[model samples]
Target: MAEMIKEPIENYGLSSKDRKKTLFSKIGIVGCGKEGSKIATVAATAGIEVVFLEISDDRIQQAFDRIGSELDMRIATWGLTESEKKTILGRIKGTLTFAAFKNCDFVIEAVRYDDNGERSLNHRKEIFHELENILAEDAIIATNASSVVITELASELKYKERCVCLHFVMMQPQSRILEIVRGLYTSDSCYNKVCQFAKLIGYDFVTVEESAGLISNRLFFILLNEACAILQEGLTTPIEIDSIIKVGLGQRQGVFCMADQMGIEKIVPQMEDLYKEFGSLKYKPSPLLLRLNRAKRWGVSTRIGFYEYDEEGNRIINENEKK
Candidate 1:
């Protein structure tokens, strides 16, 4: 299929007065990890200028390489052109500090997980405070957190109404829906602006209340936990289990496959956080997941999770799997 441009190409170099009328003309992404990079890519591809913050020069380059590689994937399928890739790259700038985000109209914090992919809530809170200092009072500040609540985080901000939570489902080619959470102090205008920005990026916004796990992740974790329990009982193999869900339940992808793609390391922390919040045994990270994480078998990124994957992120199948 040919590439689709949902709107007129934005002229990012317009004068300040003209730029002020543009919605989300400049986007800031804090911590260009997996989710952050995707958010940065989506904004830049949609003709918005994006400035992403990383901790060091090396990390900045790493983010650039990942984004470039992804764009190359689109180029391979003839969905994007080499020149278009360059233009997208040009729209995205990497910075080591929050100062570059000062002019950003909207800033989203997709803070990096630890080296082990474990989340640090305090670290995310610190990023929000730093963002508040760097951004204008009216600029929207968002967190790309699935299991973390936004209300407590926004409580520390001066313009608490500007704080919102945005969760982007990181599926391939990206999900068309954005899970948007409005905190207790989030203003109606602030929430409306974020919804408008989501539409600008070709996403349908699902307005959800402030809660741990929101809509997508909360429902997903429950299924993932159940899948883990079934697997633990040796009732079926991963392939067989996935096949049942794919064929019978009509799911595009099974729970284990989704978990693997999301990285076992990342899933554990989210499940743990959910468990802590709701005090539900169903939210507890499965022992099987814990074992895989401890073994450092983080899905496609690490080339192994519930199943093995090649460097190209394609699953490796045995010859018998062809049947």
Candidate 2:
């Protein structure tokens, strides 16, 4: 696939006049997992008051620690002023209670995707119903669901018009693209506000219609699944498969390496769910993935996967390994 350079966010579907007029002050982020924590850190750094809510006390503390460490590293690596880092860190608050979200102008749900490999409409409805009881009447709700149908999730809520999918890539502060998926019932104001927020935070936004597995993940999983199948069929070694993609397709990383980075267990469940939902053979999980995940050999964090990481965090490939 060719790399398609995207138009600037300011030049996208939203108008500049509308962008300047949108409101964004207090924001709430639910789920302090990998992507959620990054979003909170970035939004806080952009001078938006941010409150992070997670299900458990442990997770909330983890988010706080992760954000603090990341900001400190960023300051040193990028030569950011100490005062600037202090201001950014000061703007963020972490909580385990939902009441903290009462004053938020916008809420972003970064919760786990359901067993269906999509943000279940029912799940969103449950949260929104509770939120409506506690939150201000007009607070907009956005989800960070990558593949779920946005319109479906929106329609399940009483405030359907104010709900949309604001899909951020894996690492929010580093990745350039942010997809604003407008649901069928999504209001123009909500859409424009999200577009404006994306621009303010230095991200390029693309407006996509409600679809299961929006552009990036849709294309990415299809390719990743194919690569898994090729490996499962014993057509080539993992190294050879990765080399082919990198050299022939101009990809920065190969499938096995990407899978290792993503965690084989994490992607397997989604692939299995997608296969069940879409009935596509391409969505089937590879046998190797199943075996590895079953063995609890999850990547980096677990210290084992396709390649072993040394004490210094270098990936050491096993030359004599063959299944």
Per-prediction TM-score to the true structure, in the order listed: 0.90, 0.79
Off by over 4 Å in 2: 1-22, 79-82, 113-122, 171-173, 232-248, 310-323
Q: CA lDDT, every prediction?
A: 0.87, 0.76
lDDT per residue (tens digit) for residues 1-323 in model 2: 99999887766756665554235688998788777878988888888989988878888888888787778778878857688888887888888888999888888888754433244557766776666666776788888876666677666567788888988865213566788898888999888888989988888988887765667766767887677778778898878888898898877777677667666666777677677778887767767778888887876656787767775445775756544
* TM-score, candidate number 1: 0.90
lDDT of 1 by residue, 145-183 (tens): 877789988888889999999889774354778989888
Candidate 2, residue 128: how far the Cα is off, in Å: 1.7
Single out the weakest 10-residue window by summed lDDT for candidate 1.
Answer: 8-17
